[model samples]
Target: MSKQELPIIDASGPGTACCAPLACKPLSETEAAELAPLFKAIADPVRLRLLSLIACHEGGETCVCDLTAAFDLTPPTISHHLKVLKQAGLIDSERRGTWVYYWINPEVLTRMSALISPASPAPTGTA
Candidate 1:
């Protein structure tokens, strides 16, 4: 159950992989069931685009109105997608007067990035 148990490729290390290859063992049914919804949320293109749009925005956040304009979808459609992102812990929201603003959660991002790849560097002999 350690992070090394996952498959991870780190470009930072001359194409070195930092974690163990996936197990020959299949995921337990409970584990697969647990992971299903989180991946399903990201499987939608609109949600991924919304995440990218917000991520690319300066200050790492954007008003819901600002997000609505980027697509040719109804407000409710956008709201549904944002809801999925929120549920997945990919974004956080705050209300300011009439608008809802969302920003990426750095902590969650860091956790995900590390899950994708693990990197550990120790100072070598006081260098």
Candidate 2:
């Protein structure tokens, strides 16, 4: 399907019923379809590590050289993985002179986290 065909999630938009935690209720078909690519992007070990490395880096960004050093794979392989994460909207990059740097799109991660995170449960007994 074309990118436009998938449901769009607006994190900053007014809240909707769909914002409720996944464990609290089932996802609508649109929600599921919209999120599947994000899940798929992080399903691979390399991409997950790349996410962590970029997200946790100092100054909120990391150079491609830094990311490549942590993996045993060739630069092309790492680049391909980074491309997937970029396409999934998990990360953003910019070219500066000779090098490219990447940073996590915090809003996207926050939204994803909020979607999967459970709400606080009621007290089981009197506090």
Candidate 3:
């Protein structure tokens, strides 16, 4: 099969940073629709591991060659997973000579973390 370049969403779009935590407020229709694909992209076991590997790689980025070594799958299979991540905006990549280097998009990770983070505890003592 041929390699395909999927459209990348701008994770910095409106409402991404302003939304309340999941425990504090239900996701608005737009928010859910926007985020579902991202979550889905990471839902796959291989992709999730690939995301974690890229996030934890030294220097905050790694080459496709390194990623392929971590799994038993073929390079093309690994590339497919990486492509899915890139499509979801959870990761970004650049071609360097014969290799592609990948890195986590920190802003998107921060937004995702904030969305799932628990709300602060209520004050124990009333004013």
Candidate 4:
């Protein structure tokens, strides 16, 4: 990959199409590689549910304590899932004193939504 190509997740530099809906256009190899990790991060059932929980939480954020109760998995396992989300830029976190809080990165979610959503068909002339 050239200098312009970088992983979309967490990449703040130029040439990162973080907002371009996939349905609107086909992905280049660089774009595909960049987005694959983000998809993989949420591929797990637990991780997907965890993301939904956080995204749907009141005030757009949730505490680690609050999240642990929602699943049978241990705290460490949950934390690991959160870590993957964070790494993929699907979510962000902040430590509030003793508790850690997580919130969805709406931009990323919007991008994802746009990606899967079907775009309007282009106009064409017919005989």
Candidate number achieving the greatest lDDT relative to the actual structure: 2
lDDT of every model, 2 decimals? 0.66, 0.78, 0.74, 0.74
What is the model-wide C-alpha lDDT for candidate 3? 0.74
* Ranking of candidates on lDDT, top first: 2, 4, 3, 1
Winner by lDDT between candidate 2 and candidate 1: 2
lDDT of 2 by residue, 1-127 (tens): 1222222444443243444367767777977888878889899999999999998998999999999999999999999999888888888888999999999887666667667656532333413
TM-score of each: 0.67, 0.78, 0.75, 0.75
Question: Worst lDDT window (10 residues) for model 3?
Answer: 1-10
Among all candidates shown, the one with the greatest TM-score: 2
Worst 10 residues of 4 by lDDT: 118-127
Query: What 10-residue stretch in candidate 1 is worst by lDDT?
Result: 1-10
Model 4, 4-114: lDDT tens digits are 222353434223334335654577787788778768988999999999999889899999998999999999999999988887778888899998899988777655555
What candidate 4 gets wrong by more than 4 Å, as runs, is 1-25, 121-127
- Candidate 2 is scored at a TM of 0.78
lDDT of 3 by residue, 1-127 (tens): 3333323233444244433357766777776777777778888999989989999999999999888999999989998988888877788888888978999987666666656655532333422
Clashing pairs in 4: none
Q: TM-score of model 3 relative to the true fold?
A: 0.75
Indicate the residue-level lDDT of 72 in model 3.
Answer: 95
| Candidate 4 deviation (Cα RMSD) | 6.8
